[model samples]
Target: MQADVETPDYLRDAKAAGIGGDERWSIVDHVAANPRAGDLIVGSGGARKIRFAAPGRGKSGGYRVVTYYGEDDLPVFLLNVFKKGDRVNLSKAEINALREELSHLAREYRQGVMRYVKGR
Candidate 1:
């Protein structure tokens, strides 16, 4: 697989490449709002949790992407399905980006989760 996979903003971010913040926020919130995103946060670094899904698709009915980012600074991204076949799969590149973005977001979330957890 390509190293570009799962590396966010490594090349061109969905927003910088023309995608908007509102669009990115839509999915992030939608995923967080949905149960399909699950309650399991992606990494151990953050106490705060934001969830997401990468469907490698566009406006599909079956695919829902769950992404994790900081509680405050959520990564800007949206799952765009470029093709459809017998199965659903996200690109390694996209996963990488989401991961990168999620890491940044998780930091903010972590702080909040920490504060909230500690009753600070």
Candidate 2:
């Protein structure tokens, strides 16, 4: 199935990482085609970390994308992106914040869906 991908923070992140044009779309396309392409981050409330290679950087030296796929019915959210060397791992506080953010996103999405269905 074709998955919907939401990029709330991706635009800024990608611009910061010097990724745009086809490179940006490629990342979104890859994630949409394989929602489970990344590894689940511990304590991230369902966020996954996926690697995308830069033009000549290759996967090992590319960017890290943090995404959340709460459920099959929900759109995948691209939370953040950064170069591999920019950050190795998130701190405890960062993980906690991420969990809370994901929780809120899921809650909001579900509520919106409910409202849409009821309206129809």
Candidate 3:
């Protein structure tokens, strides 16, 4: 039997309902602080930068991004699918800042990607 892999819309709705701004942000910060552990700087095509990446994840059609969620799977994917990796051996504030910045950068990156793709 093919187990359902697609994320349910109810889950999305539940998430939306369950997490307010600060709660969601705290969860994001916790994930980034703990599981993901670190971030890497990446330059976009427009010379803009992003946070969090493993080395060889740059290949193929994959994105080298820094998303807030995906704690359980991303490291595995980054390690197994890519090369070159590191975690922050820095202070909590620094890691928190990096995670927060990564969250912002991911938003900008997504907008930029949409614009780029739509323009082309």
Indicate which candidate wins on TM-score: 2
Give the Å error, residue 84, model 2: 0.8
Question: What shift in Å separates residue 6 of candidate 1 from its native position after superposition?
Answer: 20
Would you list the clashing residue pairs of candidate 3?
Answer: 40-52
Worst 10 residues of 3 by lDDT: 75-84
Q: What's the lDDT of the predicted structure labeled candidate 2?
A: 0.84
What stretches of model 2 exceed 4 Å from their correct place? 116-120
Error of 3 at 111 (Å): 0.7
Looking at candidate 2, what is the lDDT of residue 106?
78
User: What does candidate 3's lDDT look like per residue over 50-108, in tens digits?
Assistant: 23222334323222222233333222111111112322233456445655654554456
RMSD of 1: 10.5
| lDDT by candidate, in order shown | 0.39, 0.84, 0.34
Candidate 1, residue 1: the lDDT equals: 10
Error of 1 at 49 (Å): 16
TM-score of each: 0.30, 0.88, 0.28
Q: 119, model 1: CA deviation in Å?
A: 22
Sort every candidate by TM-score, greatest first. 2, 1, 3
